[model samples]
Target chain A: MSNIPEELHYSRSHEWIRRNEDGTVTVGITDHAQDLLGDMVYVELPEPGQRLAAGDECMVVESVKAASDVYSPLSGEVVAVNDQLADTPELVNQDPYGEGWLFTLQPAEEGEPEELMGAESYRKLIESES
Target chain B: MTLKTALYEQHLSLGGRMVDFGGWQMPLHYGSQIEEHHSVRKSAGMFDVSHMMIVDLAGERVREFMRLLLANDVGAEPRPGKAIYSCMLNEQGGVIDDLIVYDRADDGFRMVVNAATRDKDLAWIDRHARSFGVDVQARVDLAMIAAQGPEARERVMRVLGAEAPAGTETLRPFQAAWNDRLFVSRTGYTGEDGFEIILPEEEATGLWQRLHRGGLTPSGLGARDTLRLEAGMNLYGADMDENCTPLESGLAWTVAWDPADREFIGRAPLETQRSIGVTRKLKGLVLEARGVLRSGQRVECGASGEGVITSGSFSPTLGKAIALARMPSAAEGSCRVEIRGKMVDARIVKPPFVRNGKSCLQGSPTDE
Candidate 1:
């Protein structure tokens, strides 16, 4: 479950992002966030057209034990939010990488994703923790 | 090294996050706490409560011994297999530990004590037993697993299969059985209807495996804490300890002062406290803020004074943070909890933030 593919980038705030072929990018929480949060029971996501600055709290993930703020890794407008998580939040705990992806974002800055951690660096960060 | 329960190996096998709770290595959760909680409410769940010490008392004057030992009167027309919940108090009427006293039979009684206070309880009982000729034996060879919730009994029945033998589903709440091998008691920490099964230590793993196979999810100490808190049950060490009396801890009703002449260990102190009037009280608080609440956080009462949260957690059922705090009884001060270094607005209310698998708040309708 911890196999963060080499294609994605991570933020210190625990947001994982993967750039799309278009100008948009996919964003979600990392496996680390889901593990600490026990079982995710509910999620409140920002709307598709919602505007956000970098590091803005645009979403929330509520686990059985605690509720956590999901900060935006990059300045962007939400293009699409995961509709499935509204009913099945366990996917975030089950498959944090695949079906659990939160939303797509059209970056306000073209190269903002470069500031985030790459797959290699993110793996090192998580490894250092344990 | 301290002795762990029979399920220690089983919990490890199931990939349970193990933590030392009251000296026993117990599971906090199998994998997901939310699913485990939901499983109990919607279906069935099992918890290894083997850390709690089970003491079997046998002597001619066992009934008489309990009358003076507990704050709750047990000499009042008691029958076999019936149980009474009591607070074992110190000389000053402060609770030493709250425990269940079961009348196993004539001249046979058993008391279950908290694991943290096991040594204290044994010493207290042994010191007091000399006057009444009581024999106290702590049952460390046995293990206890609680199968709790609406569907818990059926799951146990399914696991037992043909070995199920007799009627356990019909066992009324708080009743116990000393059948051929198993000692099943219709009691639980979760507010739901359930049974606590006690058997030999060797048989625990097999029974646990069977229960798991029958759809009873395994829950650890973490889920157990939330479940008990949601049900408004008190944690002995946190909610109330030797420093406070039961009367001030919202447990005044559990103390029986009837017959008046019946003197218990803490009778003098309790009576003195009653006459002096209680100063501080234990109350519940539901957080209305954005941050998470935790123990040791200051709860501001007014401009002058403050309280502290003894036990706090996010209520899975209500989807809000809740806690029990020790504060002054007289209050016109609308309370607020100090969360994340900020004094956040909070509502001080009664103990139960939720009950019977339903939310019990004003203006908020029950969810499911």
Candidate 2:
């Protein structure tokens, strides 16, 4: 079983979001996503200041087996991106939720983040898929 | 229901992530695939390969039958215990299967073939053997394990106990010796010193446990794949199939054209192909950019036309993306590979990218 923090918001695509009090949000793939992918070899992060829609594929995570696109959870302007992942993409597998956060985005609107699923729902979603 | 190998329960107990490979449920990895790959290169690892079908052939005219069946010259000399790797070809010059044949003289010969091609290979051999009065026996009752790496042989020896066959350690590469119930072969797909042991199915789990206890990391299909890929070995279905001939699949050397009189299946077509010249050739590709190359990716050769990647992966040893591609014979030097829509620079080189834990390509930084 993968860790699903109750405070985090998730997308059906498996991206997790933690909305900050300052109106910005930190986003990365959940543990479940990384676990399925296995030993990430490379990560292509979205550029800072780039704008994305609610479901745009903003990045790519590649393992030895295959490559997968990381979709955005909510529309926003990318305020920061994880620069360390370029040389050390294993962080996404090591600390997916903490130091491995892919990027932070300033939401286009406050209500758009709430449309994503809660932790309990996302846990059930993974269960149903399995 | 999918087929299960003798080690199915052992895989589950080891936390293997199972996936359907061909028709058998096999482990893709235990925990981390990269770690398992590194383990084999740096130390020792074991893989359950009982899924590969072993067939025994015995007859008075076995040698003559083999000369007619295989493209290689495995029948001319009766060198006991000599293993010859050859491609079983069809009358159309297509590769029926690739296998290892161990000559045990008039007693019989043993052949190990790919699992997926078991039924077809058997049918083909049976159909041809009828005239030679040969008996084809599939040894499904045996379980095989590949113990590979620098320390693989030592670890396996610890588990083989005193009953280990004489000349076990002295067995030359591509040779096999049997002692008691054990059949130990100094052959493996990984480019390392190791032994592939064939034993009774009932005793397999015990040997697996003992090897694991002796420090042989229980590797899965994932590491086996990367190891073989790094070694520049061919996968039966992916690298070549019944639709492709050995001449174009980087297996021309495995075909013996000597004597010029032995008429093996597909010999005429191969001769025609050799005379007419082969249009396509298999080449190795090294990505000069930061991206993972995968199978089915397209290789653009500009005016020479394009080719597809037969097998591609992130080489853990080279720490770069590498692939084997079937390109136009005229495709030479470097080419741009279309990886996920981007033209990435790649260099073509003779394969065996990593051999004996070292890079074989000249000018490669890893060569140092």
Q: For residues A10-85, what per-residue lDDT tens digits would candidate 2 score against the true structure?
A: 9999999998999999999999999898888888889999999999989999988889999999899999999998
Give lDDT: candidate 2, residue B119.
94
Task: Give the per-residue lDDT digits (tens) of candidate 1, residues B1-368.
Answer: 46688889999999997877777788879887766877777678999999999999888887888988998877666587888888998988889999988887765788888999999999999999988899999999999999998889887877776665366657888887666678888888888878889899999999999889888889988888888887778899998999899988878877889879988888888888888888778888887654456678898888536788888887777777778888887743368887545678888777677666777777666576
Instruction: Quote the lDDT for B331 in model 2.
Output: 91
Regions more than 4 Å wrong, model 1: A9-29, A40-130, B161-167, B288-291, B303-305, B332-334
- Error (Å) of candidate 2 at residue B275 is 1.2
Per-candidate TM-score against the hidden true structure: 0.82, 0.97
Worst 10 residues of 1 chain B by lDDT: B161-170
Root mean square deviation (Cα) for candidate 1: 4.5
Query: Which of the CAPRI classes, incorrect, acceptable, medium or high, describes model 2?
Result: high
Kept native contacts, as fractions per model, are 0.53, 0.80
Interface residue Cα RMSD of candidate 1 after superposition:
3.7
Residue B132 Cα positional deviation in candidate 2, in Å, after optimal superposition: 1.3
